[model samples]
Target: MAETPAADVHPPYLYPDYKSTRLRAPAQPLVRVAPSPLDTAGPTFPKHFVKDSEADLTTWGKSAPLGEKMVLVGRVLDEDGRPVRRSLVEVWQANASGKYPHPVDDHEAPLDPNFLGKGQVLTDDKGRYRIVTVKPGAYPWQNHAFGWRPAHIHFSLFGNAYAQRLITQMFFPGDPLLAIDPIFQSVPEAGRRLLIADLDLEHGVEGVALGYRFDMVLRGPRATPMGV
Candidate 1:
């Protein structure tokens, strides 16, 4: 994991405390990602990056206080390697405590009335999407006291034409929880590697400009499977 400077304890935007362990950055370059292997068709992904990217509801942020600036950037594609134009990508994170910003969360974390902990964006023809949101903090659960969630962002994406939606979470390179989190450990080791994202140390994104590439392939109809 690359080393990231410590962000102040922002009330609404909670980030986990990194113990400063050196983790190696991902080996693959920040290139577009491939679609889920389940999509045997190997068709081109849609291309509508930024074409229809917008928040269906700004209230998702809930007017919680904001830092000087914040944004999340990533790409989405399909089985055929085409961009899923205007595909809606929804995300929700805890209010700094790994607890959701919703009032129903029994956890005692403070909720940023304006920070709804949710946001949306659309993928471009290039199969990419970007969102401006505060960094989420890691919080504890009955699972573990030091059980902080690896600093991460949740991503929910709708595949072509709203047929089916894929929901997954993106984790920072070195939050220290990926090794112990049961949820993170659930996926097969081969697929588990997909969720790990690369840090944008050079893109010069204003705040935490994290980069991720997730291409969804909703297995549909009989299709020839690719021989791996």
Candidate 2:
């Protein structure tokens, strides 16, 4: 009996326009614990812990890494839409001028000595999953005076252990900074179009790259809005 999240779908741990969720949300009132046995069975994930060039974040350093080159397929359903096969996704972004090779990200753009954005994959038997990065720019956060942060891409999804993880962020479809992105408006405009991401010209790749399609849905009423 665990499937009742279709009101706002999800998002509101205390979203006061996402000012760090007002100091990291959760101000008392959430204490349920009862899952052990290693959280329902061990942490399986072998088959060489992902490596096939690590799902291609544009060849991971040493060349090819500038901007505007996409291709992010999807799929990992389960809410009866089936298909949640291998699992384990993971991603990360911000590079193409929005910076973030991390050190705390000073911003001020410019940082792509081959773009070490991030990547990882695994999910076949039909649950799909593809990547190949580039296209991330849009950053400037203080969360108030001209705050910006749209072009996202930060999913995480893992299952069959580690307490069945899940995280989200995928935006990028017309992105006018997603109308003043307060963490994507704290996601509730009807699940905010399920975190946008749908261009898919057959999943592009004729002149090099251009697909989008971001499907996730791990829960009820079409869930897919958990960017934390």
Candidate 3:
């Protein structure tokens, strides 16, 4: 994709490890957009940021079983490993019964009028975005004979309109189905972790406090030579 110029556009927040990292915004958006933005992600194209916001998606019904509660926490960074503050991140997931809120979810769960089963995160300078939500139930897909999809979440990360965007999902570890799923295996092994993050294992993270850590990576400008 053609590179956009950084102008009035806003960036997202950057983050680091357990240790603290800088939380600063750029003078403007680093990329110049076209008519708008690249939009979504698939196997064919690479996105500026790789994400899986679905981990936090849990509707009232037609999906997974409802529990005490849950939370989704993650970070957003650029190719250079910096936060892209002011960027928008969206995620959606099924309810405890494995059904979605929309009519498309023909599963068994009921619709959660209170719970949208979705959320948005605007990054800070440190690239961190967090949400409090419930764990979603496993749903059905056309992947196998029985066609049961592994427990997963869907994510949509946005950069400056014209720049590269991403749409991807995340799956929990130890899921037996990933071994046979073609799409999960499509991502390069090195980049796979970019989508699937580790679970936060604090004392009170489950029951009413399940903690999920998801990170995203967005494409940034080409490295400018020092002389320039």
| Candidate whose TM-score is highest | 3
Please write out the lDDT profile of model 1 over residues 1-228, one tens digit for every residue. 222221111111111233221133343333433445444323233454323324422334435454323445666655555555656677777655455756566666676666666666666666676665555677765544556566567787665532345678877666677887756665556666667766564533645343333334432222433331
lDDT of 3 by residue, 1-228 (tens): 221333212212222221122344233444543331233322222333434443344443465445446666777776666666656777777755566778666776575655666776666567687766666677766434566666677878765433446678877766786665545554446555555657776623654576667777666433421110
Using all chains and alpha carbons, the TM-scores for the candidates as numbered come to: 0.61, 0.33, 0.64
- Decide which is better by TM-score, 2 or 3: 3
Local error of candidate 3 at 124, Å? 1.5
Roughly what TM-score does model 3 have, to 2 decimal places?
0.64
lDDT tens readout by residue for model 2, 1-228: 122234366776777887777777767755445655555443567878988788888886788999989888988876667777787888888887888888988878888888888988988877888888878898898879988888798898875444457798888888788998888887778888988988997786879888888988664212322221
For model 3, what is the alpha-carbon lDDT of residue 220? 41
lDDT of 2: 0.77
lDDT of 3: 0.57
Best by lDDT: 2
lDDT of each: 0.53, 0.77, 0.57
RMSD (Cα, Å) of model 1: 12.5
RMSD of candidate 3 to the true fold? 13.2
Could you tell which candidate, 1 or 2, scores higher by TM-score? 1
